[model samples]
Target chain A: MPDRLLLAGLEIRAGERVLVRDGGFRVDAGEVVALVGASGSGKTLSARAVLGLPGPQPGVVAARCSVEANREVHEPWSGVSEAFATGRLARFRREVEARFRAIRGRIVGYLPQDARGALDPLWTVRRQVEEALALGRTPGRATDWLARSGFRDPASILPLYPHQLSGGMAQRVAIALALARGSRFLLADEPTSGLDPTVQAGILEEIRATSAEGVGILLITHDLRQVHRVAHRVVFMDTGRVVETLDAADMDRARSPEARALLASTARIAWRAFA
Target chain B: MRATLLAGSAVLWLVLLLGLAGPFLPYDVVTAVDPEAIGLAPSLDHWLGTDHLGRDVAWRLLMAPGAFVGPGLLAVAVATTLGVTAGALTGFVGGVLASTIRYLSTVTASIPRFVLVLLVMTIYGSEGWLLGVAAGVAWAPALAEAVHQRIEVLTRAEFVLAARAHGIGSARILLFHLLWVNGRRMVGRQALLLFGYLLVLETTLSYLGGFGVPEPEPSWGNMLAFEFGQHTANPWGLWAPAIAIWVTVLATGIVSEVFAEREHA
Candidate 1:
């Protein structure tokens, strides 16, 4: 019943433009939260803030971001986002890196939007998975972890480098590496954005199954259809602010003007696809 | 696979070793001047003929390789170390520091190497060790600058950045991954370059009366400088030491080229 992560009155600024303002949200344990918005709606910035990855030059105003688990606050550095404004980002980076190292593989997993670019070209798939495990200091057997991640032939997959694998295969390897660290919170930034529909469905389903295992997921994306299928709650962002937050199940019959406008666009796109 | 080429290299190395070992050989007759054989042309008694001083030119030629080999190698070793280390650090760790070192390298390299060697020899009193030091000083900056440029390009590579992200220590990254990996080709090239330069440096210094002590100590360069007056009458006097210097430089150049090409391939 407690929140796993909470961002209160968060404001993220890049130069003079407020990328995200009055952005407050939370993801509860074992919950899937979808962040839906148009491009430049600050959905990505909000998600990045939650993970403590600031933009190139971000200024945060009036933020109280916290991550709690087991009914106790895991991270409670009030006004910590102010570190970005004071030109202390480097120091903040070191602190975040240290904390991230401690919790990254075991407590948090990240699936970045640019899946291919995130992987090392020289390293084989298996070595990367092993590196993730070693980096996180995870305890469970590596073989069991690989099997659960849906890798059919761990032996063959392990030796092939990133360039040799297809987009879907590489994404699967990325997910495997993220999970290999035994992280409980999976931050998936458009996990299926660049994949074929069938492969996308398979990846989304894998994400769903993984989330069911007490791992909370914060899915940052603009696809309302994906939100409908996998998300428990929907947080709508507009012009760098959270315009609305509602139950995902009630989104279909929602009557708010912004919601109606979004739904109309989605329906139009869906109709065109079927035609 | 190439037996003849490998065998040829081996034979060349064997000959070089024998030439180098001439002074230390058990023969007590090195530099034994026979006044009776003075100015004699090439014959069975005095192979390669006798010098103006009546010394056996064959023995002197054999011993000449030892003089060049010792100081030449010492200069190469010093130059290689100084150049590689300076170059690697300057290029890899760029910024104001790199700029400063690079600037210094450029200035030193721009000075005529012979002039620099002469200045160093004059300052240090022209002893054999001083000559070696002068040669190293004259050659190291250029070689270091070359090495620095190579390492700078490699440092910005994505693979290096990935390695850094993995939390590998800087020393290991530089030495094992960056410097060691990229240094083989550069060092090979520098070694060959240094070999040619050493011959020239030694030759220049000995010609100027800066090599070894006074006479009776026969350096190839000193012999050439002294025998130039009699060269037309006795051409072998100049040919013997000149040929030795030429062959050594040529062999090193060939080996270096082969190494450079292999690295490129």
Candidate 2:
């Protein structure tokens, strides 16, 4: 009934080993949902599964996956491997890839980790943003998106390439590129991980602002503080599963050992900041 | 590196200029042979002396650049097109298709290039352009392997993954972003090296006679062939084309080196 992005019953396997099992989350329009966990806790893998990105290994498969966006449902991986069975792996991959391609960037944008390095080095910032706009067929200026991403002098930033941008600036440009697509949903993976505290706050503010504009966002990060800063709901993952789900404000009330440990780590840093 | 690059470029440009001007020069390899000037040493009247056939060696030497460069460019073009296409496809489309493409390239590359070119030329009738085509076909597999390997690595790069996340089509990403942006230096270096190889192959074939730039065409190879058995007191006729091939090939190596250095930088 509501405009939302949902992935449920998802399982990602790399060869014989399962990387993510039974990972599920939902993000309603205008809400910021954070997938939080420690490193190698399947946070990134789960998010990447949602995008249908291939795993690092050759035999990687995302099975039992179900995704619903804007009320249209797709069980892209369900019965996919079984139906093909053998001798048609390429066809199976193509069909699933096409399904995801139809929604990516146009309906669901992504801001990857290492946002600065993710930018095309050969292109200027303006051109990259404009390309996203053109691909999404969204009617807006690159300057408008840049401004929305917190660049005050969008004109000055436009001509600069990725190499010319500082970490904070490149992160902003990456955000602008994701936002320029005018997608109903966005997935940001560790958007402010390497940024200084001040720049981190600025980037989080941009995420909050985008959510306010009625775009549902799934913010993936290990930092619980970032979740509290911008997210409405937090899905805490451990190993390969969603171990806990709690309101961002209720992080202190977390019951799962994994979520509690994360909370304690964040508290130690917060106390250190005060001391 | 900068000095070498500059010097190489200058030499290449001079060769290109002379090659371009060779056709319009007064001394013609076919028609302007003089009965009296046979094997004359380098003098005020003739620069680079005269060949055994009484033709000015300087004019024939000028002709070799166009012969080598024109075919070398064609070879590079063909090789780059085949290599990049095969590589991009192999990288982008994984699974059995990728394996098959890689296998085919390996098989193609395994064949000796010189022998393959010789066979193709023998079948197609020996022409300089045919040499370019055969050499390009033979050399392309190496470039394809390089491109495929590069694409395999680059497809996993943050920039490429980010582009994919943004819903850019695979073809555009492969061509514009992968090959053009990240892989251009690799392509350029390989292409330049292939060009040099093609030049040497052409010269070797032409020198061996029968199936190359035949007769009065004045390719560096055939010129060497003509001057080799001569009893001329002047050795410039032989030295001129040999030195030109050496210098031109060295220049190409220099350019390729520059591309490799820039890539590392």
Q: Write the per-residue lDDT of candidate 1 for residues A1-275, one digit (tens) a residue.
A: 45387777877777787777898677877889898888888776676555455422446543666676545455534435667657776666656555433434355666777666556654567666776677667766556676777777766777777777877777777777777766677777787888998888878887888888878888888889898889999988777777778899987776666767788899999999999
DockQ of 1: 0.12
Q: Which residue pairs clash in candidate 1?
A: A19-A240, A20-A240, A105-A181, A126-A158, B87-B148
TM-scores of the models, in the order given: 0.62, 0.86
Model 1 residue A33 CA deviation in Å:
1.4
On DockQ, the leading prediction is 2
CA lDDT of each prediction against the hidden true structure: 0.70, 0.82
**Best lDDT among the predictions, by candidate number:** 2
Q: For residue A66, what is the lDDT in candidate 2?
A: 50
Q: Report the C-alpha lDDT of model 2 over A1-275, residue by residue, as the tens digit.
A: 55677777667676678778888788888999999988988888777766777622244455555545566766656555554455466556667778778777867788888887899876789889888888878888999989989999899999988888988899889888887886778888898888899999998999999899888999999887788789999999988889998888887899988888988988999899999
Model 2, B120-211: lDDT tens digits are 98888987678788888898898888988888988888988888888887889988888887789989999888877877887898899998
